[model samples]
Target: MYLYLQQQIQDVVKEFAKRQFDVDANVVVNQPPRAEMGDMALPLAMELARTLRRAPRQIAEEVAAELKKLEIVERVEIAGAGYVNLYFKRAAYATAFDQRTSGASTGKATGEKIIVEHTNINPNKAAHIGHLRNAALGDTFVRLLRSRGRNVEVQNYIDNTGVQVADVVAGFLNLEKKSAEEVRRLTEDPAVRFDYYCWDLYAKVSRFLAEQADGKAMRSTMLREIEAGGTEAARMAEIVSTAIVRAHLKTMHRLGVEYDLLPRESEILHLRFWDQAFALLKAKGAVYLETAGKNSGCWVMQYKGSETEDETAANEEDTKVIVRSNSTVTYVGKDMAYQLWKFGLLGKDFYYQPFHTYPDGHVVWMSSSERGKPSPAFGNGKIVYNVIDTRQSYLQDIVAAGLRALGYAAQADRSIHFSYEMVALSPRCCEEMGIELSPEEQKRPYIEVSGRKGLGVKADDLIDRLTEEALREVAARHPDKSQETKELIARQIAIGALRYFLLKYTCNAVIAFDFREALSFEGETGPYVQYAVVRARNIFRKLAEEGEGAKPVAISEATLAKFLAPPDGDAFWSLLYLISQRDAAAEQAVVTTEPAAVAKYAFQLAQAFNNFYHRFHILTEQNPERKAFLLWLVRKLEEQLTATLGILGIEAPKAM
Candidate 1:
C-alpha cells in the first residue's frame, strides 16, 4: 500500500506538472523529517520556479491547492517557501494496508525477462566463503525481483574446461599418476569425498606449478587435451568438474540458494558459440588479427580503458588478446560469446539436459553438447546482470564493449555488472577455523584466503561450524525438544545467521567473516531479527493458551482511524507507518541493486517491534479495544518482518 500510494502521488504530480508547465517533470518524492510534518514531501515547486520564473512560494501554494483535491490526501501544506508536504487520510491508508497485507499486488508487472548469472565458481574445487557471498547476493536479488513480480532467470556459469579445471586434471594424471578410470573410481568411492579430495589436489598442483620448471608445460598439455575433448584427460575433467559441481550445489542449497540453469564453458565451446561470435566480430571489425609486436599471431581487440574511444585509435598496452598466439580462446573471448548468446544475438544455442532437481521438484537444467529433453527457453535476456566480484570489472567491461562493438548498443546498456568486494576472514574467525596466521597477518584486520594455497574455509565446513555453534545454543535453550526438531531449528538459525551476515554489508564493502558476531541473538544480526518474529509468535501462543481471542479481529476502518489519530495514537501510528514501509524498502533495494537495504530494513523493523513489545504489554492490557489494536500491531510486525526477511533469503525460525 505504501508503494501503491507513492506511485499514485508521483503519477498525479507528473501529470499536473506537464499540464501546467508544459514540461515532463521527473517527480522526486521524499519523506519528511518528522511525523508531525507530513508522510511525504515534494520540492516540485522549487524545481519548476527556475524554469517558470515564478516565486517558489506561489508555485508551492498552487500545487498544494491542486493536491488538496485528491481523495487520498488528508491535507496539503506549503513549508519553507517551496516544499509541498502531503498528509494522507489515516482511515483510507489503514484500509488499503489491510488489503495489501492480504496478498494484494502493489507492483506493476514487467514481462521482460531478466537474467542474473552468479556464483560462477570454478568446477575444480569446493566452494569457499567468497563464493557464498556471490550466491547470497545473487539469490537475494532474484528474490527481490520476484517479490516485485518481475521475470527472473538465475544462472550459474560453470568453467569446466578452464585453466583451473585443467590444473586439477594435471594433478590427477601427473601428480597422482591416476588414469581416468582410477579417478572415476575415486569419485564413486563412498569413503572419499571427491570435492574435498580435489580441493587438496588443486592446491598441491598450484604449488607445483609455481615451484617446478616443467609444471607449466605439463599444465599446457593437459589444457590442450581438455579443450580438444574426446580424450581420457577430458573424460577425467568431466568427472571431476561434474562431481564438484554437485558438491557446490549441495553447499549452496543449505542456504536456500538454487539456480535455473548451469551453463558450462565446454558447452559454449562445443556448440560453436565462439565460432559464430568470431565471425560476427570479424565482420563488424570488432577484433583484428595482430601480425606484429609481442601480440603477433593473436586475435586482439582494442581496449580504451573503459572510456569512449575513437575507432581508429591504436596502442600496445590498450590491446587485449581474445585468441592467443597458440590458437586458444581466452576467458574474456568465451565470455563475449556468452554475452552475445544471452542477448539472443549469437545464432547458436546449447543443448539442454536436466542437471539436478531439488527436494521441491525444482529442476536445474545444464547446458550440454548432446541433445536431451525439451526445456524452457533459457537465454535471450532483455537485461543481464553478471554478479561477478569487483576484480573482474575490466573483463566485464570488455564483454559490454564487445556487445557495443557489434552494434548492440541497447544490450550493452542493459548489461549490468553487479560487482562486489571480496570476503575475507577475521582474526577471530581464522582462529576458529584453526588457520594459523603469521605475525604480520595477525596485525592486519582481516586475512585474505587463497584458493591455490587451500587456506580458505570450505562453504560446507563454515556452514557446519555455524550449525554446531547454533546447536549448542538451541540445546541450552530447549533441551526437552526432540533432537530432530532441535536440529531443524538450529539449521534455520545457522542459515539465517550466515545469510544476514553476508547481506548486511554494501556490495562494495569487504566483509570480514566472524562467527560469534553473526550468530549473536542481541545485536544487528540475523538471530536478533529471527528472535523478534519468534517473540511475536510466542505472544499469540500465550494468548491462545489463556483462552483469549488469539486470532486477530477484523477492525473497522473507523476504529483503525481512531487508533491512528494523533496525541493518543502516535505510538500505534508510528508502528503502522513502519510496517507500511516494507514494500517501499523492497522497491528501494531492487532499484539500487543493493540487498543491504533490505537487510538494514529487517533489522530496523525488528528493532521497532522489539521496542513496541516492551512498551505495550499486549498480554496484560486492560482495555479490549487497545489490546486488540496492540495485537493487530504485533501481527503486522510479524507479517512485515517475515516478508522482509524472505527477501533477504533469511528464514524466521519458529524458536530462538
Candidate 2:
C-alpha cells in the first residue's frame, strides 16, 4: 500500500507537469522527519523551480491543490521552501493493507529465473566461521528474492578437484602414508569425524609445505593425479573431498540453509566444459598466445585494471594467463566456462544425479559425468549472482570481462558479484573461547582467524556453543517446561542469534563476532526482536480466555478511522504505517542486494510493536470499541514482524 500510494503521487506530478509546464518531472518520494509532519514528502516544486524559472513555493501550492483530490491522500500541505507533504487517509490505508493478499511485492512475478551460487567451500576441511558469513548472507538474499515473488535456484559450488583438496590429499599420502582403503575405513568409523581430522592434518601439511624441502613437489604430484582422475591419489581425493562436502551440508542444514544444486569442479573437467568455452574464446579472438614476456608461451587475455580506463595503455603487467604452456587451464578459465553455462550460452550441459535428500523431501542434485535418472532442467538463468568474498572481486571482474569479450554483453551485465568482508573474533570473544592472544592482538579491536593455521572457529562448534548458552537461559526462564521443548526452543534461539549477528552488518563492513552481544535480549539483537513476538502472542492467548471470546471483534473501518484521528490516533497510525511498508522494504533489499535492509526493518518493526505493547493495555481497557481497535493493532503488528523475520531466515520461537 505504501509503494502504491507513492507511485500514485509520482504519477500525479508527472501528469501535472506535462499538462501545465509542457515538460517531464522526475519525482523522488521520501518520508518526513516526524509522523506529525506527513507520511511522504516530495521536493518536486524545488526541482521545477530551476527548470521553469519560477518560485518553488508558488509551484508547491499548485501541486498541493491537485494532490488533495486523490482518494488515498487525506490532505496535502506545502512546507519549508516548497516541500510537498502528503497525509494518507487513515481508513483507506488500513483497508488497503488488510486487503493485501501477499506480503511480498504487490503479488507479481518477474517471469525470469535467477540463480544464486554461494557457499562454494573447498571440500577439504571443516567449514569455518568465515564460510558461515557467506552462507548466511547468500541464504538470506535467496529468501529475500523469493519473498519478492522471484523464481530462484540456489547452487552450492563444490571445488572437489581444487588445490585445497589436493593439499589435504597429499597430507594423507606422504605424511600419514595412508592408502585409499585405509582412509575410507577412517571415514566410516563412528568415533571419528573425518572432516575435523582433516582440518588439523591440513594445517599440519600447510606448515610442512613452508618448512620442508619436498612438500611442494609432493603437492604438485597429488594435484596432477587428482585432476587426471584415474590414479590411487585421485581415488583418495574423491573419498576425502566427498566426505568433507557431506560435513559441510550437515553444518549448513543446522542453520536451515539448503541448496537445489551442488555443481562440482570434477564434472567441469570430465565433461569437457572447458573445451567448449575454449573453442568459443578462440573463435572470437578473446585470447592470444604470448611470445616474449614473463608470461611467455602462455595463452593470455588483456586485463584492464580499474586504475586506468585507457585501452591504449596495455602492457605486460596488464595480461592475465588463462592457459599455461603445459596445456593446463587456470581457475579463471574454468570459472569462465561455469559462468557461460549459468546463462545457457555455452551450448553444453551437465549430467546431474541426486547428491542428498533433506528430511523435508527436497533433493539436492550434483553434476555428473554420465547421464542418470530424469531430473529437472537446470541453469538458463536470466540473472546470476555469485556470493564470494571481497578478495575475489578481481577474479569476478575478469569473468564478466570474459563474457563481454565473447559478445555476451547483456549476460555480463546481469552477472552480479555479491561480495562481503571477512569475519573475525572480537577480543572479548577470544577471551571467552579461551584462545590466548598475543599482547599486540589484545590491543587490537578484533583478532583475525586463519583456517590454514587452525586458528578459526568451526561452524558447527560455534552453533553448539550458542545453543549451550541459550539452553542455560531457557532453563532459568522456563524451568517447568519439558526438556525436549526447552531444547528445541534453545536451538531456535541459538540459530536466530547467530544468523542475525552475521546479517545485521552491511556486506562491506567487517564483523567481529561476540557471544554476549548476540545472545542479549535487549537492543538490536535477534532475541530482542524474538521476545517482542512472544509478548504479542502472550497478549492474544490471554485475550482468548479473558476478553470477548476466542474469535476476534468485527470492528468497522469507520471505528478504525476514529482511533486514527486527532490526539491519540497518531501513535496507532504511525505503527500501522510502518507495518504496511514490509513489502517495500523487501523490494528495496533486492534492488541493493543488501540483506541488512530487511534485517534492519525487522528490528525496527519489533521496536515499534514493543512500544505499542507498553503504551496500551488492551485486555484491561473498558471501552469495547477502543479495546477492539487495540486488539486489531496487536494482531497486525505480530503478523508483520513474524513475516519480516522469516525473510531474514530467522525463526521466532513459541516462547523466549
Candidate 3:
C-alpha cells in the first residue's frame, strides 16, 4: 500500500514538473521524523529551486498548491527548507486496505532463473551450529526472492570426494582395519547414527595425523584412492558420505530448510567435468603451467587481485594452483566447472536422478554420472548466489574471475558471494553443555566451533535441547493442552527460536549461540513476535465469546472517513501506515541481500501492535461504533502480522 501511494505521488510530481517547469525530474519520497508532519515528504522543490531561480520555499508552496488537487492527497504542506509533505486520504487508504486481496502480486517479474547454493557442508560428519547459519541465511534469502516473484532454485553442493570424507575413510581403513562390507553394515545399523560415528572417527583421525609421522602420507593415499573410485577405500567413502549427507538433510529439514538439488563432486569427477573446464581454461589462457617457479609442474591461475604491477612484482602468494603437480584437480577447478554449468555457459550438463522426496512432494535431485530417471532440468540459471562463509571469499572471487577470463562477463557480474561470518558458542552456552573451557576461553565473548576437533554443537543436538526447553515452558503455561499438542507447539517454537537467532544478526556479524537469549519470550526473540499474534487472536476470541460477533463487517468509506477525522485517530492511523510498508521492507531486504532487515521489521511491528493492544480496550468500551472500529483495527493487525511472520518462516500458534 505504501509503495503504491509513493508511485502515485511520484507520477503526479513528474507531470507537474513537465507542465509547469518544462523539465524532467526524478521525485524521491521519504518519511518525516514525526507523524504530525505527514505520511511522506518530498524535497523536489529544493532540487528545482536552482533551475527556477527562486527560493526553495517558494517552489515548495507552488507545488503544494498544485498537489492539493490529487485525489489521494488529503493535504499538502510546505515545511522548513522547501519540503513538500503529503498527508494521504485516511479513508481512501482504509478503503484500499479493505479492497486489497491477499497474495496480490508485488515486484515486477523479471522471468530470470536464480540459483542459490547453500549448506555446502562436507558430507563427512554431522552438521554443526556453523552449518546452521549458512542454511538459515540461504533459505531465508530464497524466501525473500520468492516473495518478490523471482524464479529461484535451491542447491546444496556436496563435496563427497573431498579430503574431509577421505580422512574419515582413512580412519575406518588404516585405524580400524575395517573393510568395505563392514562399513556398509555399520551404516545400515538402525541404532548406530553413522554420521555420529564418523564425527568421532574424524576427530580422532585429526589428532592422530598431528601426532603420527605417517598420518599425512596415509591420508594422501586415501584421498587419491577415493578420487580414483575403484578401490575398497573409495567404496567405503561413498557409504560414509552418502549416509552423512542424508543425516544432514534430516537435520536441515528440522529447521524447515530444503534443497532442490544435491550436486556432488564425485559426479563432477566421474562425468569428467573438470577435464572440459581445464580445456576451456587452457584455450582461454585463464591458467598456465608454472614450469620454472616453486610451483613447477602445477597449473596455476594468477590471483585475481594481483593484476597490478607493484603487487605482481612483490610476488605475494598470488598463484592459485588449479591442478596439482600430481594431476589432481583442486576444489576451485571443479567449482569453476559447476559455476559455468549454473549459467549454461559450460556447454556441458549433469545427468540427474531423484534422491529424496520431501513431505511437500518436492523431489530433490542428485547429480549422477549415468541417467537413472527422467528429471526436471537443473541449473541454467541467469544469476547464481553462493551462500558460503566469509573465510572462502577469496576462492569465491576467483570463481567469478574464472568466468570473466572465459568471457562470460555477464554471468560473472550476476554471480554473488552471499558470504557470512562463522557461528560460535557463547561462553555460557559452552559451560551449560558440559564442555570444559580454558580460563582464557571463558573470559572471551565467544569460542569458535571446530568440527575436526569434535568441539562444535551438533545441529540436531541443539535443536533437541531447544525443543526440550520449549516443551517445559509450554507445559507449565498450558497444562490444559494435550501432551501431543504441547509437543507440536514446542517444536514450532524451537524452530522459530533457532532460525530467528541465526537470522537476527547481519550477514557480516558473528553470532554467539546462547540458549537463554534465543528462547526468552522477551525482547527481539521469535516468540515475542509470535506471542503478539496470539494476543491478537485472543482479543477476537473474547469478542466472539462475548456474543459481540468479532467478525468485522465491511466498513463503508463514509464511516472510515468519520472515524479517522479527529486527533484521537492519529495513533491508529500511524499503526496502519507502518503495517502498510511490508512490501517496501521486503524489497529492501532483497535488494540489500540482508535478511536481518526483515527480521527487524517483524519485531518492530510486533512492538507497535503490543503498544496499541494495551492502549486501546475494545471489549470494555461501551460505544458500539468505537468498539467495532477497534475490532477492525485488531483484525487488520492480525492479517499483516501473520503475513510478516510467514515471510520469516515462523508459525504463530493459537495457545502460545
Per-prediction CA RMSD (Å): 2.4, 2.3, 2.5
Q: For model 1, how does the per-residue alpha-carbon lDDT over 244-278 read when each residue is reduced to its tens digit?
A: 99999999999999999999999888988899999
Taking the candidates one at a time, how many backbone clashes does each contain? 0, 0, 0
Local distance difference test, each candidate: 0.89, 0.88, 0.88
Candidate 1: list runs displaced more than 4 Å: 22-24, 51-54, 104-110, 305-314, 431-443
Residue-wise C-alpha lDDT for candidate 3, range 388-431, written one tens digit per residue:
99999999989999999999989999999998999998999999
Clashing residue pairs, candidate 3?
Answer: none
What is the full ranking by lDDT, best candidate first? 1, 2, 3
Q: In candidate 2, where is summed lDDT lowest over 10 consecutive residues?
A: 101-110
Model 1: how far residue 285 lies from native, Å:
1.5
Local lDDT at 245 for model 1: 94
| Per-prediction TM-score to the true structure, in the order listed | 0.95, 0.96, 0.94
